[model samples]
Target chain A: MADFSYYIFCAMLLGGALVVLLSRGYVNAAMGMLCSMLGAAGLMVLMQCYFLAFVMVSVYAGSVLVLFVFVVMLIGDVKENSSIWRKIGIVGLWVVLGAFVGWVSPMLSQAAAGLSKTTEVVFLSQAKNYGLVLMTEFMLPFQIAGALLLAAMIGVMVVAKNPSRKKARRELV
Target chain B: MSYLINQTATCMPALLGTADCSYADMALFIVLKVVFALAAIIVIMCFAALSVVAERKVCAYIQGRYGPNRTAIPIIAAIPLVGNFLKKNGLMQLVADGLKFLLKEDPLPAHVSKLWYLAAPIMSLSPILICACLIPFGVWWDSGGAAHPLAAANIDVSLLAVLAIGALGVYGAIMAGWSSNSKFPYMGAIRASAQVISYELTMALAAMSVVLYMGSVSDSPLSLFEIASAQEQSWFFMTQPLAALLFIVALFAETNRLPFDMAESETDLVSGFHTEYGSFKFGLFFVGEYGHVALGSALFIILFLGAWNPLPYISYPESWGWISTLLGFITFLVKISAMIFFFIWVRWTLPRFRYDQVMALCWKCLMPLALANLVFYMAIAAI
Candidate 1:
């Protein structure tokens, strides 16, 4: 049953990606992206990453996709303006991907042959497990990344809130 | 992999009995669970319908108005005392209202996005319906001494999953408003998206505070059942009243109830996002909104109000088994009903907040308070 679900989710993910690439309407693309995210989350659930799956759905489909749709609606639906060359390029990229997958299959098997023989189901991605790892083993890197993000946010605000530029705009008005 | 196989094999019998079931039996059990879940959703829809009537009755009583108590069928009125009581009390109004919705014409407006316009109500309703499975109404201890939850989808990260599902409902309203191709609905949708997103932060944060508290208290994973069981000594509401208050307030906004119902403020936006919607589609939206309320209430009870516990700090014993489970179920239902009543009471009593004021309250007030609460709990936990 899990395998069946995995196959279904894989099909849905591919279908959604195709829809995103091929759909004319922006909202349709957003909806397709939503479907793709949901499919990905289902695959995560199949892997027992339940917390990650829920987080992906909540953050990506729930919030980020809503923002995407909101922006799409705000701008209104626009016809896809891709040239024939771009479409050809996208199709050619897919062909390349397929060829690369075929070529790498043997190499992947060779790499797998060198790996340790550990067969236990590792439920390492549960939220509690994640929290423990983040706060203990990866604490420094996590804090650094957080600080970097905070700095970036502050930089954006400072750039956007230039007093001189605002004064000039106010004067013009 | 073997665990997964074993789970699939034994899951049905774990809840039903100790019978070694075959594939068909397992399939039948799943089918039965799905049926039960659907039935539960229908019951929520019924609750929504009744809540509408109750709202009218409560509002009328408060304002000294008669409301819709006189809409009775003549034949039913001739069945003596019970009929007169039903007629006088507007018992059939729910039937009448349902029929009206069913019989009414659903006209698609010109120049509207037909697909999204039609899909909006379904999108709105689906999240809450799916989230209902995460709620554990009761926990029956079987003869084999294993506790079996009376829920459809029993996942470890159920709280997070439900919240995720709740957040998805905003799309339905946005889709409805934007697809309508009209000014009022457009504004309503925009407001709804903004409001829901903003309040969602506070809602999650407040719930996180509860989670942090539970984590510290019980040393268990952050599941709703774990949190409930942790409250055996004292409910989280008693310890974390501030978070509870923030959760309740944010829930009102999240469900788009009054005081934060900027999405559908009748005065300014002319019935808000559903202005273009009519008939059964509109009824679906209605059911969806009430489902959010009911689900939100259930979450509140589970998180802070001591879910399935008869009294505060007085949890049911596991040794009592089925009797305790039944009482737990009753306790859950009673808590949910009380919470629903509280929602209605607030809706009738308070005035709606202006859109700007609503945003300000969420971002400036509630968000900060929830963050502080989280930090405070974290500090205490660390200590």
Candidate 2:
């Protein structure tokens, strides 16, 4: 049953990616991205990472992809130019990407299984366990990441500050 | 893995065993889960429908008018004293409203995006209903001393599941706005998305504060039932009132209720994202809003108010757990209903905020307060 679900989610992920790449309209592409992200989240659930799965959905599908859809709407509609050569190129790209994924997937699954075995604790992916590991084992790196985000947020504020208002103040001075 | 499997399997009553479970068990479990889920949804739908009537009645009482009281069935009104009483009290208003919605022609404006316009209402309504499944409405212990939650889905991280799924409802509002291709709804959708995204941060932070407190108190994981049980002696609202306050405010915005209803402010955006929506589609959005209010209030009770927990300093004895569980369930329902009434009261009493003020309140006021509350609690817990 789990294997069947894996196939369905993989199809959703791959199909959604295909739609994102090949769809002509910006809104369509955004919707495709949403589908792909949801598929990825479902895959995370299958992998027994429930917290990460919901985080993927809440952060990506909920926030980031919503912003993406809104941005696409704000930009108005984009026209698709469909040509034979573009279709052929996309098909070729799919073949290469499929081959790469097929070659790498087994190795990735093996590594995931090995990690689970090494831990000797299946519920380590639970939120409390994750928090324990994060706060204790990776506290420094986590703080650094937080600091980096804070710096980036400050940069955004500086960049987006009203330049016209600044110029007006300078002129008055 | 077996522990995790059992936790999930409890949600499916048919598959209550381990690897030795038969196919029959699995099939029965799936059927039972579906039936339970359907029952829960129906109960929510009824609540949503009745809440409309309740809201109107409350709003009218607040403004000194009779709202929807005259919408009685003629035949029922023909009856003696009881009929007149029912008619005057607006008891049949829910039925009348449902009939009206069903009978109305669903108008699709020629200018709208056909696909998304049709899909928007479904999108808006579904996530809230799905999130309802994860909420623990009551707690009952089996004869074997195993505690069971009266909920649909019983996974850990129930809090995050609810938040994440609830967040997806924003797309429905956005889709309604953009797909409508109308100016008012477009503005409404933009406001809706921005408002939701901003408040969600504060809401998450506030919830995390509770989660952090729970973690410190019980060393239990971030499950709703666990959190509620830890508050048996003292509700989180008493200790962490600030977080509860922030969460309530954020919930108002999330449900698009008045005072923070920039998305569908009738005065400004002409019904907001639902400006172009009418008939049953509009009904879905309406019901979805109420469902959010219902579920949001339930979550608040669970997180802060001590779900199914009796009064402060009062403990339910384990010797006769069933009676205590029943009392707790009743208490939980009463708390949730009171919260819903408060939602209506606040909606009518307060004035709506300007879109800019809404954003500013979330980012400038609530966000900072939540962060400070979280840090303060963290320090206290550490000490």
Q: Give candidate 1 misplaced runs (Cα > 4 Å).
A: A83-119, A136-145, A159-173, B1-22, B73-78, B144-146
Q: Give the C-alpha lDDT of model 1.
A: 0.83
Candidate 2 chain B worst ten-residue window by lDDT: B11-20
Residue-wise C-alpha lDDT for candidate 1, range B49-98, written one tens digit per residue: 77777777777877889878777877987899988787777777877988
TM-score of chain B of each: 0.91, 0.92
- Fnat of candidate 2 is 0.59
Distance (Å) between predicted and true CA of B220, model 1? 4.3
lDDT of 2 by residue, B36-119 (tens): 678667756766776888898999999999887677788988899988887877888878888888899999999998998999
Alpha-carbon shift of residue B261 in model 1 (angstroms): 0.7
TM-score of chain A of 1: 0.74
The pairs that clash in candidate 1 are none
**Error in Å for residue B116 of model 1:** 1.2
lDDT of 1 by residue, A1-173 (tens): 55577888987787787778777788878878888898999888777788889999999988878878777777777978888888778777766886798799999977876673545545755577878867987799999999998999999888888699879999999
